[model samples]
Target: MVRGRFAPSPSGRMHLGNLFCALLSFLSVKSRGGDWILRIEDLDTARCRPDYARQVEEDLRWLGLAWDQGGSAGGPDAPYFQSRRTAFYEEALGRLREMGLVYPCFCTRAQLHTASAPHREDGLTVYPGTCRGFSPEDIAAREAAGRKGALRLRVPEKSITFTDGHLGEVTEYLPTDCGDFLLRRSDGLFAYQLAVVVDDAAMGVTEVVRGADLLTSTPRQLLLYELLGLPAPEFFHFPLLLSPDGRRLSKRDGDLGLAALREKDSPEEVIGKLAYLAGQNPTAAPRTPGELIEHFRWDTVPRQDIPLPPGLF
Candidate 1:
């Protein structure tokens, strides 16, 4: 059976862009008679809130996008929240450590910013391997200086290739593109790359459908899957939903959030608008989730970022 998921970070309410991804993910699985899972990616405790998480679930329910497993639904894999799954991340980190593929990185954000690191299009700076070859004495010295280090995976200079369900074949070099990346943060929190890979594999997720913004992240996650001996799922990265001004919709854009949209529009109105944006429907007429699924086609979805039509809200 094909198992899919819509993992949302509950730092804020769901925006139109987030709803677009969730609807696609839901339709892709449901249309094919597959199970849909809803995983709350509340890893960043400092920013993630219980109220936001609760609101997220309510919003999805209101939108008529339900999941088969995870969150309140429950499944074989319990504790759907990433914050509650730290032990799994630690175990995976321990395996990497035993294999000599993990190292302590003492590079502070200020130090990294000053370093001549290659910047990716997504705005992430590639690590310069400053602490990749750190010795025990070197690490001890840094610890003595009251500096706690993060854990980084020792990425080899090799290329990785994978076929995206929507975008076709994609390739990236590990060391050159995204050098030894972080598996754990300096504050002892597990990084997204590590946590996501571990959770997907453990939960038996067969496919991953997310935004194209994360297309560059697939290669790094692929490396983790190989290192941790986990099966990498098929990925489909859809185009992002941009604002009328060509900016990506975010939490800062409060007017574009579900909380704001709910006050004026019905669930069908919201779903219909997003479906039209995703190239699934001919018109932006109100439609149910099941009604839209009949027209959901990966090829029909645009490859480029879509600008939100004027007066969409």
Candidate 2:
């Protein structure tokens, strides 16, 4: 069975962009007689809160975007939250370690962002393998010097190419595109790339529907899948729903978060307006998720970032 997941990081309340991703993921999976999983990505407990996660569940329920499994609605795969899945990440990291590809990286942010550092077009400063060949003695010396290092995997100078379900072909060269990315943070936390891949594979997720802003992350994730010997899911990264002023909406700024929007609009009203914004509805009239599914088309959804119509709410 084809299973898709809507994994959201609950650092804040759900915004329009968050809603856009949730709605599209739900519709795409449901339309195909597949199952949907709602995984709460609370790996960063410093920012993630129980209240925020509860609010996300409340918002999705209000819009009637029901999931077959995950979160409070548990399935065969219990403990859907990332915070509860550290052991899995550790095991995967251990596999990489056993393969002799893992190494300690003590490079500071300033050192990495130097003027001579190679950067991808997306502005991610490539890790120049500065600590790629660190020996146990070198690591001990750095530790003796009162310095800690994050763990990085050694990546080959190879290109990873994959076809995105919505955007077609995509390619990324590892050495320059995003060389030897982090598997764990220096503070002893698992990286998002590693955690997500582990959780998805364990939960049997076959498809991933998320925002277009995460398109560049797919190749790195694909590589992780290859090294871990896990099956990678097909991706469909939808375009971002921009603010009226053409700026990306942030949960930090409370940009049209559902907590406040729900007070002013009915659930159907909110879902309908979101549908209109995604080109799935003819007008911004009240409509339930059930009503919008008949018109939901991957091709009809705009391929580029869409700016909200000012004063439409």
Candidate 3:
């Protein structure tokens, strides 16, 4: 079956903007008789909370979105949490290590802030390879001193490009425009790019439906896949939900999350409103998940940012 997933970090509650994304992903997969998986991205131990994870499911259920597999209720792909898949990331990291595609970096946040290239409008920061050549002695000394460091991918000096299903023909320069990025942080946690690439491949996800905020990072992820000899998943980056002030949607706006909306809004109305926000017009006031799926269309979904309304619903 064609597969898609709605992976949400358990760091915060699900909001209206993200709700639209969830509905879009769920409906898209179901309409085509595909499987929709839910992966809880609780890799950030410092930020992820068990309560928040449970809240994610509750909120999604409240919004009428369901998944065929994943999460605490495991399906075909058991052990869905990224935190539980440490060995998987270690194995992938080992591959890059053997291929000499990854290197140890001891740069501190302050050092990186000073060394980074000018930020792009899309928030691209080229990281100059500073500790890419740290000798064995240097690593040993740091270990002895109990000083922690991050592992960075050795970005190549070439143009990385891919055709996005929604955006089309996306491209970016890696070494010059983008920069070598972290695979593992000093806290011994896997980086977002590393964990996502590893998990998606392991889960056998076919299509990835996410917001456009991640469009620029595609090239880097592609490079990682090529290095690991893994097939890349098809991408559909739809419009991001934005704040009324035209900023990208964030958890800070507690007023936008589904739980916050449920206090005053009807679930059916909220779902239909989000469908319309995705550029699909429902024929009737069908108030269930099935009806929303019947009217969802990939082509009709808006490709630009959807402004956060003063009130959702």
lDDT of 1 by residue, 247-307 (tens): 9989888999887899999999999988999888898999889897766788999999999
TM-score of 2: 0.97
Error of 2 at 298 (Å): 0.7
Identify the leading candidate in terms of TM-score.
1
TM-score of 3: 0.93
lDDT (C-alpha) at residue 79 in model 1: 86
Q: lDDT at 238 for candidate 1?
A: 96
lDDT of 2 by residue, 84-127 (tens): 88998999999999999998889888898998888877677788
Lowest-scoring 10 consecutive residues by lDDT in candidate 2?
252-261
Off by over 4 Å in 3: 282-286
lDDT of 3 by residue, 2-30 (tens): 88899998887877767877887888778
Flag the better candidate by TM-score, 1 or 2.
Answer: 1
Better of 1 and 3 by lDDT: 1
TM-score for each model: 0.98, 0.97, 0.93
lDDT of each: 0.91, 0.89, 0.81
